[model samples]
Target: MSTPTDAAPAQPGVRKAGEDLLTVTDLHVYYGNIAAVKGVSLSVKQGEIVTLIGSNGAGKSTTLRTISGLLRPRTGTVVFDGKSLVGIPGHKVVGHGICQSPEGRRIFPKMTVEENLELGAFLRNDKAGIAADKERVLDLFPRLKERIAQKAGTMSGGEQQMLAVGRALMGSPKLLLLDEPSMGLAPVLVDLIFDTIRTIRDQGTTVLVVEQNALAALRIGDYAYVLESGHLKQEGVARELLKDDSIVKAYLGG
Candidate 1:
């Protein structure tokens, strides 16, 4: 497997004209007899915060899983930084500069906060770079710096969520895939998490986020897609979607 040192150019050979840093075409993912993501296609520009917002069972998470290589697509292509990510393994996907903070805060329950972060940098040989990124992540979440020696599973829900995002940052992903980062958080924590996401993009990482908190997600996002029952229902600039009556009434609680 390629390590982070083998870091491919951030973008190369692909179309240099458009803003697209990652593109998915006719993507499809199936679990046995059921297809969770059905022929979905989308593009995320470099350094832009794009969101996929939808109700449960709408295939938002499945689309994200497929892109991060946790599940293979039955059909379609995932192009990231100009490389086809069709057959890469999940770990290799990270090496390709894509990392995900998966749904449900899937942190290492038995590991210390620092240990979990070290795991995220397992592919990088540059110890100094890893340490620097760790420090930067901690700066972004000072609450985590205080809990460095604590067990990940014992932290508060907000702390655990911060740890998840921090772990993904330890690798310095060029494209970050976040799955429902606000799933069960208190409103205040939700705001903090969303603010952190904006900071991540501001620092130049392209983001493709899936969130059920439609309003909050779109409010901070540059673009948004609305999905329903494994199909795309609507898509547009985030502010425009926020003003669309159908979108506001259907997904934003009217």
Candidate 2:
């Protein structure tokens, strides 16, 4: 298997465009007897939005879980900012500057919106920095600011999704892992979520998104990977993939 130092080359003329921040090489993960991720290798640069676009059950979420330390890889390496994150506990992953807004939002339903956002900074002690980040998140999702005292579960699905993204931002992540941010939202909210993702990237947080919304994901991503049954099938500049006949037909519903 290829290691981080000697992984296979990326697609021709599709080299990573910025400084490498996260590198997953030859990653293999399993659930009991089921091999979920098979030798998946990908990279995220310091200031780019890279997306994994694939169908359900394609191991995209499993890859994100492993990178966030929620699940351990049975083999291979997860190197973030040059340090191996293979055995780091999930909670500690936040301290290393990576945070995930998992699929299904996963907010504390009974908690107020503000309370839920506060929990994201549990690992930090820098009061001023945390306060600044809260304000930043609120700015990014002003709807959240208006509903700060409302119970999270009382909100609509789109609102809950915004809160999830905001909560992840409260952690002040250098690399944000967003899984299906547009899931279960109305068309308008989907547009808003994608807009917010671009804003997040413009504001300096690199993002690695796992999205089934292929067209929308490709629109905002600087680069993209197409995964099929736990293996990489295609990868290239997002615009290039968007134009590819095969990619459009298979994932973009062309």
Largest TM-score belongs to which candidate? 2
Q: Which parts of model 2 have CA positions greater than 4 angstroms off?
A: 1-16
Candidate 1 achieves a global lDDT of: 0.87
- Per-residue CA lDDT of model 2 for 1-254, tens digit only, reads 22322111254336555668999999999999899999999999988899999999999999999999999999999999999999999989889999999999999999999999999888889999989999999998899999999999999999999999999998999999999999999989999999989889888999999999999998888889999999989899786787899999999989
TM-score of 2: 0.94
RMSD of each: 7.8, 6.0
| Local distance difference test values of all predictions, in order | 0.87, 0.91
Candidate 2 lDDT score relative to the true structure: 0.91
- Tell me the lDDT of model 1 at 33: 83
**Per-model TM-score versus the true fold:** 0.92, 0.94
Candidate 2: residue pairs that collide: none
